[model samples]
Target: MTELRIILFLIGVAVLGAIYYFGTRKKVDIEDELDFSEGEEDIVSVRPNDLPRKKSGLTVDEAHQAHEAENVQTQKDKIVTLFLHARDGQQFDWHLIQSAAEQVGLEFGQDNLYYRFKGFGNNKELIFMVANMLKPGIFQPDMRTTGLVLIMTLPGIMPALDMWDTMFPVGERIAEILGGKLTDENHHIFSRQRIASMREEMREFDHKHSIQ
Candidate 1:
């Protein structure tokens, strides 16, 4: 019985040793296989041109301008169509539009302004009156009414302005016929700072128009 017990103990020890050796060797073999599959010689070759580098001196403004200008142009293309017509059959004035355009610079009409005139209090019919005269079919801002309309649509485009604050700039529209007084009640969405900045911009805009 003692001899049998010794033989059984020896057999148990040999089995545990075999299990430990095989377990360690199996782990090593798995690691080797992974390394071999991912060998340096098998790595993909990337040319210097294929490696993308961060472009230097790229501004957010430039990127945005590029992205927006990727397709059609003109402010009319950017948003829902709104036509500008002079009341009483007076011709829409080009000088006025040019002056307003000058305020915002050469890029003014490039998909930034989109005007929908609901009119101030007591004047809900204004939009219908203007629309009735619109020539059917889509058109970019006409030579006549471009500048005056640009001013109203220019102020609310900063990235900081929340979508709700994107109301039209009712003040400083710079047209003798219109823009004298719109009630400020509905326009309170703008910060005082924004209004002040817009006014200053219009002043500069007017100055540019005078020179031309």
Candidate 2:
């Protein structure tokens, strides 16, 4: 009888151990299934470089051309960058900085905004120099502006700021200065009319792409 009892106790432990092992495996299987399902649904977000920098739907050779296209005027010879947010935009906030620069009469050359940087931040900023040598606290509208409109679909995914994280905090600080709270929930952050127009423009752009 003692021998039988000991055998039964050992069997019970073996059964319990098997059950625990199966339970742990079942939990792991459920987690694997969840991860697979989530992975199928979520599309990976891409960086600018990761995406093919297409022959931009639009391009401008000079800041003056970009400025005139946007209907903004600038007298000061400062480069106006749209940061990483601008896709088709040539010039934005050109007049804002130009106006401020005019106040100080701190004249620079138009050639400055033309050169491409070989060993600087990733966007290889052209418009950034204006914000670099800033006389801070002068243009106190809470941010930098050039009177030029920034044309981009995703404003939040600004990459120009990330590129210049090493040298100084100019791009990020300037972006923060430019952005502000939207008064109306329906109102767009970038531009009121242009934002509304972009939906139609996107459809046309898509249609044109499909035809090709």
User: What's the lDDT for candidate 1?
Assistant: 0.28
Candidate 2 error regions (>4 Å): 1-82, 86-91, 99-107, 112-168, 180-212
Reference-based TM-score, model 1: 0.23
Runs in model 1 lying further than 4 Å from the true structure: 1-85, 104-167, 170-212
Q: Estimate each model's TM-score.
A: 0.23, 0.18
Candidate 1 residue pairs in backbone clash: 97-147
Residues 125-209 of candidate 1 have per-residue lDDT tens digits of 1111011111111124443321111112211222212211233332234233443222222222245785666456545544554
- List per-prediction Cα lDDT, in the order shown: 0.28, 0.27
lDDT at 111 for candidate 2?
23
Clashes of each: 1, 9
* Residue pairs with clashing backbones, model 2: 81-127, 92-148, 93-145, 93-146, 93-147, 93-148, 94-146, 95-146, 143-177
Q: Please, what are the lDDT tens digits per residue for candidate 2 over residues 1-212?
A: 32222222222222222222222322233322211111123322222122111212123243234435333312211111232222232223545444434443233333221122224534332222222211110123334322211111111122322222311233233344443221111223436574345345444444554575
